[model samples]
Target chain A: MSERTGVIHDIGYRPYTGPREGRWGIVAGLLRHGALSTFGFGRSARSKVLPFGLLVVTLVPAIVFVGIISFVGMDSELLNYAGYQQVTAAFVSLFVAAQAPVLFTRDLRSGAISLYLARPLGPAAFALVRWASLVLAILAFVVTPLVVMFVGGLGAGAEVRDELPRFLVALAGALLLAVLLATVGATAASLTMRRGLAIGGTIVVLIFGLGATAILQEIGREQGVEDAAAWLGLISPFVLVDAVQHGLGDAASSFETPPDNPTTAALMLLIALAAAAAALLLLVRRYRTRGSR
Target chain B: MTVIQTRVLTKRYGGSKVAALDSLSIDVGEGVTGVVGANGAGKSTLIKILLGLLSPTSGDATVLGHDIRTEGEAIRTAVGYMPEHDCLPPDMRAIDFVVHMGRVSGLPPAAARERAADVLRHVGLAEERYRLMGGYSTGMKQRAKLAQALVHDPRLVMLDEPTNGLDPAAREDMLALVRRIGHDFGIPVLVTSHLLGELERISDHVVVLDAGHLLRSEATTAFTADTGHVLVEVLGEDAQSRMGQALAARGVAWQPRGQLLEIDPADAPPDALRDIVRDLAAELGLGLVRIQPQTGRLEDVFREEVPA
Candidate 1:
């Protein structure tokens, strides 16, 4: 036999006399991994199938929307950021519902959060950082296509002057939607340690909220209750955000009767902020009391 | 140095009348100190309180000079914890998970990876470190958990049942690893066990807890040191009286109990007393059953406290 070609050295436990990065280092590490795990990185190949598939599903429509504007130069309703989100809401909701538990439930289920809390990061900060990572990932899902459509349309000869304002409005809507979706996801997922249950719960909130409100608003309008239908616009996340943008005079409302004054926009904004804050508080409490142990 | 100090720390689950940890105090110093107790003895609760995973209902504690209440984050930064339950993410490789935990313990990425590898090797998982942890054995999983705790090179490590569910050989290996951490590396270790026998050999100090109360906290020697007594048993119809009277004739102080004699072995050399007892029994044509020194075991410490 030849002499040994490999050696496994027992370096023993050496004092880590090196620099300790403390809180921000933990934050950065968790955030980076948390965001990546949303897209199924650092996990199994089987885990990658869903998030990557959702990204492609989300991207294909974005590519086609830009293609239609470029080839036909059609004055399409699906030309703006909020409009893009409106069209892709189902796919984006599916993505968030399916993947949010990847970040939220797996850690809680495995009792890994206790180890995390055993670090310098507190339970509240842990929840927030995890919330931020999902926000980043969902933003990527919403923005990747927005960027594609913007550049692709510009390449197809759409004027920047005509498109820039609409682009900015959609950008703001995407941020708000991402934040709302992430908060909902964290709230739903952290409530249970079961991944399937968490995913189903998030789907119910994101999709059920949008579906129920949209259907009710349509029925209310057909029943000649236009006031009620418009008020129903304040119910779901996407329509509520659309109402806000419309109130701000940037986009038309998805509702039959759009908000005519800025007061409704301000009121809706306040409600949205309050709701998001409540959901975030739930996440923090869950981490502190249930998830950490 | 006292690495952990607690005073009147208490934890009570709301509905349960019995407090999990009821007004307990202990000062653990710079070596392997074993927290020995039976099931539901609040060992895990104590660990959680120290790690700041659960807040105490009352009183105060400090870990590495940081208050457990206000400075939980600082204590967490300086201390590593190996939880009793499963905490490893099964889908990830050992190296990845340990590195991730190292970062969570506040080390930067490169340092985290470097120390992760070193600690994994130290835990004897170097060969299998690249495999997903779900595929590993229980011993491997335990070592992986230990590796994450040591990866940050914490000032102290609080391991909850480190030898739990291991076969005897594996338990021996883990205890040795724990001793090396406290002794060779000079890092303080607070290890818990349900069995006193396992920790008795490795721990420099043993703290016995019974039902949310401290039974005793003392050096290992205080628990195991020999007392100045020896027991001798002789076999015969009237063995007890014959041996006692024979030892008295030989000027050895002795007390007769059924089938045995308790000798103080006072003044005379212990070996001499043993020889005389043997010679006396033989001359009396009696069967010498046994001669033994009565050294205190850590278990005896518990038995003494709860004598029936």
Candidate 2:
């Protein structure tokens, strides 16, 4: 037989893998998948815009009232940078915690997660990429507000030039809080495919953590144990940011002695980072064992 | 060598008395291998397990030399699967969805997009691929599903009920595409269909599964080549009666069946029977419309194996 006939015989008159194409394997897995799943992120963005718009609407009235008060020559710090930092931490942590299940669990329950798992990428990479995108989204929600507040404070002439360090610290603290809450919510949501139940579960978890602190502090006050009551405030995400803000401004920390102190701040940072890492591990494990024995 | 091999694979659903797939073993080689079974015959179970989408309760199977248990990630990357249900995210466009699937199979961005376009065109969805799949008709949706399976360009493609929810023309088109996928493209295609007759036409080999058990597996030719009857029809009134009388006079083993006469061609002398039947039909002022041999149809085989 001729060479061509031999090749045809090798092809065996059956379906052949159309051109033997070259691939770089898993190293390129991330870039290629990131490009493809851009559509998924686009879909997620479309779903988030309305709620984000609602949040903007809610903040608009406050922003306008603050602007009006500043414009009327009131000798007041309506755009107080430190005060806004407290709002930033509260909103970022609570909002991310409440919304994580909506953004994360819906994809899994809809079987869209199957498409990702079916890819050449492993569960570890998939979990990390998804968590990263979620963290970026949460950061946008939290950081945008803080940036606006900083500019507003400058415009309000609250002598904010000397307070740049404090503002920067607050920004970093808020970002860490946002990332931590987003990861926690996403991890909890990953345990179940049902979005509503996952969201409800996340809310209950956050409430339990922060609510118990508030209740403990109230009871401690009744028992006349003021120092013990103060310790319970550490559970609140807002309190952590307030502590950091006060520490940056040379004030006694609300959370601990010197919020920027290597020992105390490092411990807090470790706890937040550990939560994020644990959440990532849980998500990866769930992805690996999905629908399997 | 077997492209796919399974040994006693099984799946038991929750609270179910019987297993969905019970210790079933089958081998598939390259070509169009049609998996034939009725509803609830464990066809879906087998495909899912082979795709590594479902974990088996026991036993083992391998696809393209990849173990079904631990090597599922590799198996999935190498194999293409078109699920039976309406699993498509309807809001996405066909091209985008197929491109996404291609990327998932490790295709680079440029190659995935190029293959997606080519596959969409190949499936006859060139224009409709731009529209969201939600607005597509059933036939179009099936074609889109088919396009995604082809977009990845894997070594083996498993299609589940590609003709489901299709009209006759659409079903024929789908089957033709399946045949071409095997014959024209030289890609091994394992397709499942509840209709055995359809599979018989397109499949080089057919594997029959009946209630979680292997009923039959052979080349389509082998199962169909053993019919004992030949049907003879004459083009006139009373053709049946006249043919019956002629056969009886010759002592040929035959029976009258509806308008035509069914005769065991083996028992009758071939030349003499033909001449006698012709002469009798002519003498009775009738014409012989046709004389043909009959073989068992796949549907008949299915009915024999699983009665409903």
Quality class of the docking in candidate 2, CAPRI style: incorrect
| Whole-model Cα lDDT of every candidate shown, in order | 0.85, 0.69
Q: In model 2, what lDDT does residue A199 have?
A: 61
Candidate 1 deviant stretches above 4 angstroms: A1-11, A73-78, A291-293, B15-17, B231-269, B280-292
What CAPRI class is candidate 1?
Answer: medium
Enumerate the candidates' DockQ scores in order.
Answer: 0.65, 0.22
Mind giving the per-residue lDDT tens digits that candidate 2 earns over B13-80? Answer: 77677999888888899889999888989888787778676788889999999998888777777777
User: For model 1, what is the alpha-carbon lDDT of residue B284?
Assistant: 87
lDDT per residue (tens digit) for residues B145-249 in model 1: 899888899999999999988999999999999999999989999999999998889999998888888888899989888777888888887878887887888
- How does the DockQ of candidate 2 come out? 0.22
* Candidate 1 lDDT score at position A189: 85
Candidate 1 overall lDDT versus native: 0.85
Winning model by DockQ: 1
